[model samples]
Target: MPPTIEMTTTWERTCEVADLEPGWGEVALLGTHQVALVRITDEEVYAVTHHDPHTGAPVMARGIVGSRGDRPTIASPLHKEVYDLGTGECFTDPGLALRTYRTRIVGGMIEVELDR
Candidate 1:
């Protein structure tokens, strides 16, 4: 039998919580990936890929922040594709999906867990 090895995930600190405005998305560079950081409230923040899956353009930071029912969503500025901020599920297109990252706040700073 082979020994089991455990993997640990590292969280990268992006910015201060005060740096993001509510209902707006900001772009943060994580290594070679561009992430769109959106703050829904003082304690709620979401991190998603800045690349638009439908258009293959990096314009997700300019997306409009809104809500569908109780779910927080962002609509692409280019094609108006709505995506769930928490799950990365696209509402406009069944074949398209957005990439989402895990986010957390610690000591007044925003941290994101990027999949490398």
Candidate 2:
């Protein structure tokens, strides 16, 4: 398990922490947007837009988790384009990107800063 990262900003509850399994990903609807949620570890969770930039398909939740050097990544299932989970930068194509969201666990629930 990784150390807890305390986020200072206010967070909106999205789902229960247990709703996502470690080492895997899930999709959650935030307002009208679809957010991809990943439980990378027992104490680490990441959220990003579920849309795959290359195909504009909501397929990121189905992406395979991986790493590029030290950076954690997820490859789009549709095109296999790799994207950094932390920055949403596409490693396969510099011109492409995904919207990253700040996520934190609070009271055993998953929360995210949707505006970020």
Candidate lDDT scores, in order, read 0.95, 0.87
lDDT of 1 at 54: 92
Clashing pairs in 1: none
Kindly list the per-residue Cα lDDT of model 2 for residues 2-113, writing each as its tens digit.
9987656446789888788876789988777799998887678889999999888999999999888988899999889999999999899999998999988888898898
TM-scores, all candidates, are: 0.92, 0.86
Residue 113 miss distance in model 1 (angstroms): 0.2
Clashes of each: 0, 0
Whole-model lDDT, model 2:
0.87
Model 2: per-residue Cα lDDT at residue 33: 77
- What lDDT is reached at residue 71 by model 1? 100
C-alpha-based local distance difference test score of model 1: 0.95
Model 2: residue 44 alpha-carbon error in angstroms: 0.8
Task: In angstroms, give how far residue 106 of model 2 lies from its true place.
Answer: 0.9
